[model samples]
Target: MVNRSQNVYIIAEAGVNHNGSLDLAKKLIDVAAEAGADAVKFQTFKADNLVRKNASKAEYQTRTTDASESQYAMIKKLELDEEDHQILIQHCDHRGIQFLSTPFDFDSVDLLVHKFNVKQLKISSGEITNAPLLLKAARSSKPIILSTGMSTLGEVEQALAVLAFGYTEPDSMPSIEAFHFAYCSVEGQQALRQNVVLLHCTTEYPAPFEDVNLRAMDTLATAFGLPVGFSDHTSGIAVPIAAVARGAVVIEKHFTLDRNLPGPDHKASLEPDELKDMVRSIRQVEAALGSPLKTPAPSELKNISVARKSLVAARTIREGEIFTTENLTVKRPGDGISPMYYWEWLGKTAEKNYEADEKVRR
Candidate 1:
């Protein structure tokens, strides 16, 4: 979905780190672009649609924001209108970075896909079971990156079934049975292969390293035959870099101009400099991944003679003298008979006299 055909699609997620200021949001875009991210992402939603007035903030949100504030009140301050979305889209264009946003409601999805025309839709982990939203996203036909956190294999499969039904547009009405039928169909699987990318994520802010479960990422790739990526919520750059090394095809991590900035996600996000380091480190890991063949590298050829050992005369040996372990030994400068032939050379007559430490080039 993120054109993972090239390098891992690095998304510098600026999710609500802008503190609801359009200027701050623009600055975050600049930071992501400067850090060499493929895209900059923000959250798009109306507070009323996303949370109830009585809903309490999560434990981390309460710790980060006003403890007295309702979840709706906290998010209300951060809602970005359609006008703001357009400004961000324009800013991302100016900065030469792709724009992405997670849509929390159907209207937000329409605004992003139909109005601003973002290249893809980022579905957050909390929305994995939002079948209506997933179907709406697929009906739009823009590629989707669905995050799987706080979900099981069955739940993930169920979500994908909803997506498959929407992508295929089967004749029957949308229902659990229909979704399952579509998911089992060859045509539905093909549509999913072309339209969706799954991201393994830990939903908590500053997710615990132990909870990251990178092996589960491999499980995602095996269980679902689509490209898989990491939506990292860990404290630093290491987890994401390690994910790239372990075959993550895309990476999404949050960033903020300053971690001290008053926002729900800022404390867990990378500062400007750290974001750059993560991108640089991911690129380096990609280079290091290289080909899977177990062979010497191009740079290693010249060092073989210096580092590897070869058979050589341990002491002066006269011509016609029988070779033995005492008269022959392994030494460096491998431009001669390899040590692998030591057993064969034993008991064989020396073809010519050799000086001490001289390579036995037979």
Candidate 2:
């Protein structure tokens, strides 16, 4: 069970996939909670406040929707209002799961901090360069989780600098509340300061297997002295479970009601059933990662004799004959000399006659 006991905190990212429908959004929450996700996350943003009316969409965004529409226009249509927030929060309560959201604009962050009582503040990748947003988020003093996709080490370092020391006055440095990282590489962890958690991630939507580099998660923890995790963009549940095996403490993935839905994030997002499977798999893996001890476990101890081997006589040996490899071998029912004592038992005189397949005693 050494491999299965690690718990990966799974966050079901319901980013703008509700398609401006509160009913769909509530259903999404049900899906997340029912899937056993530790938390359900939504994107809190005002289209006009987050980006200029003329700002364009990312390439992936354009591919999913009409290329001519502005990113603001697309988001504005998909915006979740105050009423929606109230309902979603209450729905999360009813569903018995933590409610979380990533704020894209200053007002959205303030609203989440003051109105919803959100336990954790999530920083999306685009905001890594937005110093103003980072400062505001830091001031709220909530535990922060950062997405470092599309950022270089220097960019991450700069973001950390803004949070760690740059936000305070020139003469007074303030202590950050909490900092956590999620990325596609171990190199990203170098940009983090002390007390940070690094999560393995891939920037690509529905990230390719070759780009995962999951082993780098342990490398981050070992090299940077911090806890590690994963932010999966892979379309399936298998990668997240695999990541937990690599020692991920966090698991964040996009989730929506339907993959066939008409939204930029829907195609790569997990449907309700798939999200459930992902959570169940993660929990199962967590149960499996047990302790690291090599000794027999309490439960496994009873099977030791039945499963392990002990030294035994390969053939009948008359009393007073010296023990040799020709007459001694190893077999199960470990109640006699261990195979490790083979050398000591070799060339020794037997005190009594030994039958074939009988355990060898000192």
Scored by lDDT, the top model is 1
lDDT of 1 by residue, 1-362 (tens): 37767899999999999898999999999999999999999999988888889999888998899899899989999999988988888988899999999999999999998998878999999999999899999888888999999999899999999999998983457999989999999989999999899999999988999999999999999998989999999999999999999999999999999988887888999999999999999999999999999999999999999898999999999999999989999998888888999999999998899999988867
TM-scores, in order shown?
0.98, 0.86
Clashing pairs in 1: none
Error of 1 at 194 (Å): 0.7
lDDT score of residue 100 within candidate 1: 92
lDDT (0-100) at residue 288 of candidate 1? 95
By summed lDDT, which 10 consecutive residues of candidate 2 come out lowest? 176-185
Summarize candidate 2's per-residue lDDT along 169-216 as a digit string, tens digits. Answer: 323433332232222233334433332455556788878998888876
Which residue runs does candidate 2 get wrong by more than 4 Å? 1-6, 166-200, 215-226
Off by over 4 Å in 1: 170-172
Candidate lDDT values, in order = 0.92, 0.78
